[model samples]
Target: MHLDACTIYRYSSYFIRVFTHIYWKSAEPCLILQKNPTRPIALDLQDIHKSYGSLEVLKGVSLTAYDGDVISILGSSGSGKSTLLRCINLLENPNHGRILIGNEELMLKPAKSGELQAADVKQLESLRARVGFVFQNFNLWPHKTILQNIIEGPTQVLKIKKRPSDRCRKIARSRPTSKKKDAYPANLSGGQRQRVAIARALAMQPQVLLFDEPTSALDPELVNEVLAVMRELAEEGRTMLIVTHEMRFAREVSSKVVFLHQGVVEEIGTPEQVFDNPTSERVKDFMASHRPT
Candidate 1:
């Protein structure tokens, strides 16, 4: 019996899902859900610092996002906005910091090179699965159809079964790409592709979503399409940390606006305070220059 690649992949995925489900189910009692009853913190970064060789990118940056908070991180170029977002999921590991998702701290151990590394690979993987990240560039597989791209994470990394994965795919499609489910990524427009990226992240059903300048790569006209989807997500009360240059959108949607200056938090306040009545001289200057007319 000669099995084709697709057939083999399907069977293998099924077995992996079944086995993982059973294993995790048996281990459920050992898992702890650490959450504060009064004020639940969705994501926390404490004194995060990251450097490249001699150049420091992030300098003791700290941020906290409560449940349902839409935090928009604003800054001038080279202020480590994207670096900070990437550090949340350890895509670029911070040299020193504490990161917690839902009060569960990510375990890290110092390496010989003086960099922090995940102490337990399994724990890191588990925590990473809970945080979804959307990039500036729409990172989609050119060969895969929209449906396949959306379901890939849940079915593979999450070990979700076919039925549940399909459900997730449906939800994702409904949000962003319903009309183009069967189309390959190459066939879609830039806006459509970015929406697909968002849908792909949504299909993972992450507890917290990170947007690293998601609209930066889109054309001026296409930028709003991506922003509109993001606004809907914000309205749905999803906990999101957005690193964006869209000042108007940030002013309109953010529960909290953070201004990063020279790798440190220059200011943090409500959108009204940050945009309309900023206290810091640097923040005031930034707002004055970048504020949409």
Candidate 2:
């Protein structure tokens, strides 16, 4: 019952690590969702390719999103859904491709192994700011309180002042704020953490928001809470790219649905076209397997 300071510290450290593991998984994945492009094109990916050694993950994958476009990239595991999203946000550079945001294209230089990279760090940072990304596991910092996490990007990266973020206020209104605004991630539930993650992305005021399996990490009961927030955003006409297995959500929310097979765009069209009548054998087979009971 009476533990030494060292023993208490060790237990605390172990609990933090274990809790973080349970709540936040690895952070990289691909999902391209577009909102109303303030410009002609919000986010464009041209013939993107990514390979790990000889195994090519993304092969000639091209995506184009315009104003008010909610495109869902759907596919089975290993179909390169996540890889595609990673490339767009530059989390993982594509072996070869061109990424354009608005009227400006990303400047890149050839890196080793035929890959491409941002010509300069400043350019990459600038581009990332315009594109918001929400990971499956809410990547909120365990040490920082909810408010601190939400405002970090705006103040640090975008050089925004300490003025309150709209998103933070929105989230705060959802629940009674008995805890300090600085309440750590450990104090929040899965759905709350994911909401904070969304707020963090929205605070940047991204032109296009990318969600990589946003609801996959939540408990079945918690999934709807996160999805509701996303739905509200979609209703507000935010451009979103979601890579998910939530077929119903995709069909209901997205204007266009893209099916990727073996790293290539297999089928793409309006949800009705892709879901109701899939042309490709690969898509037909995939849908058949995933059809709800």
Candidate 3:
């Protein structure tokens, strides 16, 4: 069929437009769109609440952060962002909520003897070992070398003791996390210090790591190095929950972006969907007022 030149050009342009749209939209949903996930639920927070002196912080927040998932809880300061992270690890006690880590349910309320129930304590300890938390300020012990910092949790908190076997020494010396021993917090750059912090967390062999503004304390030029390390962690399939001010990093590295406002979860979705088409007004206001600055 011989068509006029103008008609042929219009049809070709229309087809090209449709093809491009399909191609771009196919990759839209971030990493959560995988067909068959090995574990469906990793951390499920159900109807969680928090308060101080009758002032409510978290008002029935419910959400899930999955295994091998890089999730971001993004919000303005004092919006209970830090509180939520602390609640997850029981660093901050919640008033009312059911926190489930894998199959185990945590006792949010304190017990009579100032101790968790044996089974609950066991599960809490296990989850604590499995979940690692990283601070925004590089919390490396100034007195300890990188090697000591890395192994401290395993040896002390987790009660993993080691004998001086040749194999054990080899493991201690050559362990990937311990290789940073030469660098001290005072001598190392911001990025290196943060990496040491991450290594310290990783040395505990946690299934997931929580990042509390991994790059917030770095110089603008140094931010990328910390982000690169995080990207590497993501590629290695370590589950991570990041609370960051880095909108671009959140967009780039997270499988899910959660917007928190007034101690409540306002929106949760993939980066593109959340950033480009947020369903909530608070999210829209946030996305507009503060971009990457």
Candidate 4:
């Protein structure tokens, strides 16, 4: 797929500055944040609510995730963090709300039969398909090789042909810095397995990538590898949203850090703004008490 050349070039230049800054004081980890009111919003969620039986997980919530935003949603377990993500993807429908992705209308609270058009579903599904998801557990197929796992989603779901030489293609695209050429999931380390899972997500040619605790399942030592890969993706300027507990990674990599409390967006702002001077006690308490494990 062809990307915007100018945008891609800027993305590369930004990374160059990042590495150059590491070597000298010439460049200092520049983060050019934009709160441009004119930029089109990428995602819009309004009056979102989810309930399971007697339990109400998400109260009415509204937020906008804008273009070129790399956001991290941090909250304790049972805070409706994952469920909110599910609602975004339509994996779990919101009780009452409208989710607009670009120009398409996604979620529906079930209007009268003739009230909602069937074409809305198609438009929304197409939109969802463009967004890739990385699960907490590396959900790679045990039967397929690493290369096979990477290309299978594009082949099966997107109806693209899987090349016989896809193993080489995967390596070329991933540019694996390590030497595990033809390894399977069982033979690969936790980090490598997660990398394969990530490669699979990228092979689908997604516009936005959503990571749900991508490194939570890995051991402490292996966590850095997965985080490093994510950092590289951010450098590539891929629009991404992540739900994670890694505060250091959040501070280092994300443009916007959102503190979700009780399913509501308590605070959302730049990492330094939120980290250095949090306005909400809920967020300050949450940050003060929880250290990376």
Task: Compute each candidate's TM-score over C-alphas.
Answer: 0.83, 0.82, 0.79, 0.80
- Stretches > 4 Å off in candidate 4: 1-32, 107-121, 162-181, 291-293
Clashes of each: 0, 12, 0, 0
lDDT of the candidates, in the order given: 0.77, 0.75, 0.70, 0.69
lDDT of 2 by residue, 1-293 (tens): 44322222233322122222223122222233433445477778999999999999999999988866788899989999989998987899898989998778999889876788889889889989999999998888898876677567767787654444454455444444425455788888887788778877876668999999998998988876676666656666678899988777787778789999999999998877888799999899888887732
Judging by lDDT against the true structure, name the best candidate: 1
Q: Which pairs of residues collide in model 1? A: none
lDDT of 3 at 191: 74
The local lDDT score (0 to 100) that residue 137 gets in candidate 2 is 88
CA lDDT of 66 in candidate 3?
70
State the weakest 10-residue window (summed lDDT) of model 1. 18-27
Q: Candidate 4 on 205-252: residue-level lDDT in tens?
A: 667788989889999888876777777677666677899999877877
- Model 3 Cα shift for residue 161 (angstroms): 2.8
Model 3 lowest lDDT segment of ten: 13-22
Selected candidate, larger TM-score, 3 vs 4: 4
Model 3 residue pairs with clashes = none
